[model samples]
Target: MAEKVRVGVLISGRGSNFVALEEWNRRGDRAYEIALVASNDPDARGLMAAKIFGLRIWAKSHKGMERAAFDMLMDAELRRHNVQVLALAGYMRLLSPEFIRAWEGRILNIHPSLLPAYKGLDTHRRAIEAGESFAGCSVHVVTEELDDGPVLAQAKLRIRPNETPEILAQRVLKEEHRIYPEALDTFCRTLRGEAQPTISSDLKK
Candidate 1:
């Protein structure tokens, strides 16, 4: 392993996606390593899980601070840890524009609902109500606009008959766990001029 890229994962709540990324990185056959797991809320359930892995954890409540202040605090911690890439797992906070520009092209996110559709919360419900045949998740670059970044990869699942939003969310989450790490892997590898994006492989439905 020739100095894999150092990655920091950000999350706000239960970090199932963070676990996926960490597990993948732990496999010892990757272009990146998980250096830090950070959260805005100290009580986030994911923090406890990170502890089980003995991973470095950082947390600060964003309660009173301005968004920029909180972002900078997290930013300083990331820089201190020499994190080269940021994977936003389930981070619920909106990032400040400055932070986005500071780490442009270095941040990745996993979003539910095939994107360009339900850009924010309640994605599963929207998809179910629309009578769409399929629902999916996306891993993409984090831009200033919320969930409006360039999609790097996606995994889709067909909508089941009479499916409820809760059930749909559960299914989409599985695909989210499946593809986020892969997308992050390819994004770093390709950006480093190591390989080209495999379009055929990315459309994993």
Candidate 2:
């Protein structure tokens, strides 16, 4: 059997995506294991879920810390946990260039908008305002520039008429859950010298 890579997931909110990824990891034999769940918010509900899943969890609030300093702390902890890959699952903080460079190609993130589209927040609202026919999500490498990275996978959902951001988010989130796990697994396997397709897309009509 192929050895599983150690993946540390970072999250800031309720951790819906973290749950999705963990569930995917548990379903079968795969290329990666969610070794740690780290967050800037100690109160993140996802931590509780991670506990239930028996995943190593770490949290340190970033309220007063410098951005670069916090990223350094994260790096130390992830290294301590023997993490090989970092997955950003709603991790809100923008990493410093130092941290990005340290991780280099070993980090992956799932962004709400099909990347290179809405790089920042309010993606669903922005897409609706722009009259976009479809709103989507992307799993990509985490580069220094926000949401600017080589996309590994994407899932596009058709924008419904007059869809609210909340409703649209619910739809797009389902796809995020679907693609992120597959994308992360493929990336991990590729790094391990396996011949795997690195990019995939689901065009949801």
Candidate 3:
């Protein structure tokens, strides 16, 4: 039997998407393993979610730590877990370029926007304010430039004119739950050499 792909997830919020990934990993048919959950916010609720699954958790705050110091600590934790692939679900911090280059194409992130659009926070509100016909989420490979990485997969939903930010956010959340795990499955399968490299070449550059 082939070995399961080890995944290390990073989150900075309640971890709704993380919950979905955990559920997928629990299924007997899946080919991936949940190796660890790391959070930049010490108070992030995802830490509790990780505990519920008995997964190893790492929490580091940048309160007094320098950028390089924090990156070094995070690098140590990732290496400790021997994480073959990394996923960012609602992770808030801008990872240092050094850290990203070290992990390179192994890291994935789920962004609330369709991507190459609203890159940072307030994604839902901005989409609504723009009167967009559609708003969705994206799962992309992490690159040095924020949200500029090659796209893996995306789930899009039409925006209702009357939609509030909260409503739009919830709708986007549903797409996130679906696409994040799907992208992870794609990534893990590729790593195990069980699948062809379906990821976009644009991501590596």
Candidate 4:
């Protein structure tokens, strides 16, 4: 049997996507194993969820710290666990450029909107206000540019009539849970020198 890829997840709030990844690992996927769950917010509910699953957890307050310094702390924690792949699951902090250069293609983030569309927060609201017919979640390689990385996979849903942002968020989150694991699986396979799956759309021109 091949060794499982060591994955570290950085989260800020409820880790529904983290739970999905954990569930996938538990189902004998053998593609990756979550080695660490770290959060900047010590009170993040995701930490408690991770604890319930018996996964190693790290929590530190990033209040009033330099970006590089804070990211270095994250880097140290991930390295301490020998993590090979990092996933940002609802982690709100923008990673410093140094951190991005160090990790390069090894880091992944799941965003609540299609790329080149809504890059920052309030994605659902923006999409709804723009009268978009579809809103989805995107799993992409993390780059220095916020949500500007190459998209690996996306799961889209049609906008329901009169759908508010909160309602749309709830719907899109389910797709996030589904596609994130799929993207990670493909990413791990690529890391192992295997043939990459064709799940990704080309980088937005």
Best by TM-score: 2
| Predictions in order: lDDT | 0.87, 0.91, 0.84, 0.87
lDDT per residue as tens, model 4, 101-158: 9999899999998877898999999999999988888898888888887888987788
lDDT of 3 by residue, 164-204 (tens): 99988887887788777877887788888777545321111
- What TM-score does each of the candidates earn? 0.95, 0.97, 0.93, 0.94
Consecutive 10-residue window with the lowest summed lDDT within model 1? 196-205
Question: CA lDDT of 66 in candidate 2?
Answer: 96
Task: Compare candidates 2 and 3 on lDDT and give the better one.
Answer: 2
The number of clashing residue pairs in model 1 is: 0
Q: Please tell me which predicted candidate would have the highest lDDT against the true structure.
A: 2
What would the per-residue lDDT of candidate 1 be over residues 1-205, giving only the tens digit for each residue?
A: 3567889999999999999998877875888888999999999999998999999999999999999999999999999999999999999999999999999989999889787778999998988888888888888789999998788887778888888999888888888888888888887787678877553223433
Model 4, position 128: C-alpha lDDT score: 95
Candidate 3's displacement at residue 125, Å, is 1.5
Candidate 2 stretches with Cα past 4 Å from truth are none
Tens digit of lDDT per residue, candidate 2, span 1-205? Answer: 7788999999998899999988998898789998899999999888999999988999999999999999899899999989999999989888899999999989999999977899899999999999999989999998888898899999988998878999999999999999999888888889788956566777886
Q: Point out where model 4 deviates above 4 Å.
A: 200-205
Better of 1 and 2 by TM-score: 2
